[model samples]
Target: ITVEEGLEEEEITLPPLLIQPYVENAVIHGLAKKAGGGTVAVHFQRDNGALAVTVRDNGLGFRQEEGQAPSIRHSSVGMTITQKRLELLGSA
Candidate 1:
């Protein structure tokens, strides 16, 4: 759970607004797929002069357009929101 290095650190760049929703989706839908509990890891750093944040989980992966299990729809929303946010941020 690497969050902003510091709120006041001028060198820290905040990700575009939609990032939160994408993260929420990964936890809700992605990790939730695991039978037992799972770990969600997130990292933030400066990569090649650009900010890079990644969310990862150990859970069942999916294929394009594949319907998620019924219990997983709630989580998928987050990913969807994140994608939209990135698009709006012109980062897509």
Candidate 2:
């Protein structure tokens, strides 16, 4: 995890909580789909007035057409929850 400091004077804003789960899912479940190990990159930066966090994995990515089942351990909760959480944040 990467952390930035020197923000006490600035406001403390947080990304949607569901996004947290999305990140975890990407690292855990996404990598499991791959045969061997892969790298998971997480980028944290300030964009305009908001914080931007990007989670990327080199593992096998998902394709919607597959309609594959969600991992029993991980579920598809990350995607579903993250999307809804982002929507709520937009309204706020």
Candidate 3:
């Protein structure tokens, strides 16, 4: 896991756990499946007036399971909940 911050001296605040699930997914689903392991790179930057975060992994990409619901497919429950929480806070 590597974190690269490009925010410089700017400071921003986000709701708790806004980014954890993605990182967790990258590690558990992405890197964990590879035989020799891989890297998870998290980049944070300030683009225009908004904060941008990018999580990249060299693991196998996602494939949807058959018979899964559209809303839940390819997404963990924690991610769904975090999205909802962000929506409620008007930050998503």
Candidate 4:
């Protein structure tokens, strides 16, 4: 895994949990199943006092063939929880 932080790190404010779930998903759900190992990249930048974070990976992405079912392990609840956390942080 790699992390890239932009120059604006000291000037921006961010929630503690903002970047964890994405990075976890990138590893646990995105890259772990690939035949060969892959890389996970976490990027953070500050834009106008806001912190921008990204987690990316080169891995076996979600793909299902015809008559195939989607993976049961994938769920949208993590993202939903993250969104709610952000909303709560914003309102605080």
Candidate 3 segments whose C-alpha is farther than 4 A from its true place: 1-6, 63-75
Residue ranges of candidate 2 with Cα displaced over 4 Å: 3-12, 63-75
Worst 10 residues of 4 by lDDT: 66-75
Clashes of each: 1, 0, 0, 0
Q: Rank the candidates by lDDT, best first.
A: 3, 4, 1, 2
Candidate 3 Cα RMSD (Å): 4.5
lDDT of 3 by residue, 1-92 (tens): 33335555445577778889988887887777579999988777777777777888887666566443223346459878988998898878
How many angstroms is residue 73 displaced in model 4 relative to the true structure, after the best TM-score fit?
4.2
| Model 2 C-alpha lDDT per residue in residues 18-87, reported as the tens digit of each score | 4577567776767876787788776666667577667887766766766542543334666776677778
lDDT of each structure?
A: 0.65, 0.64, 0.72, 0.66
Which stretch of 10 consecutive residues in model 1 shows the poorest summed lDDT?
69-78
What is candidate 3's CA lDDT for residue 33?
A: 59
**Runs in model 1 with CA error above 4 Å?**
3-9, 15-17, 64-84, 87-90
Candidate with the greatest lDDT versus the true structure: 3
**RMSD to the native, candidate 2?**
4.5
Estimated TM-score for each candidate: 0.59, 0.57, 0.73, 0.67
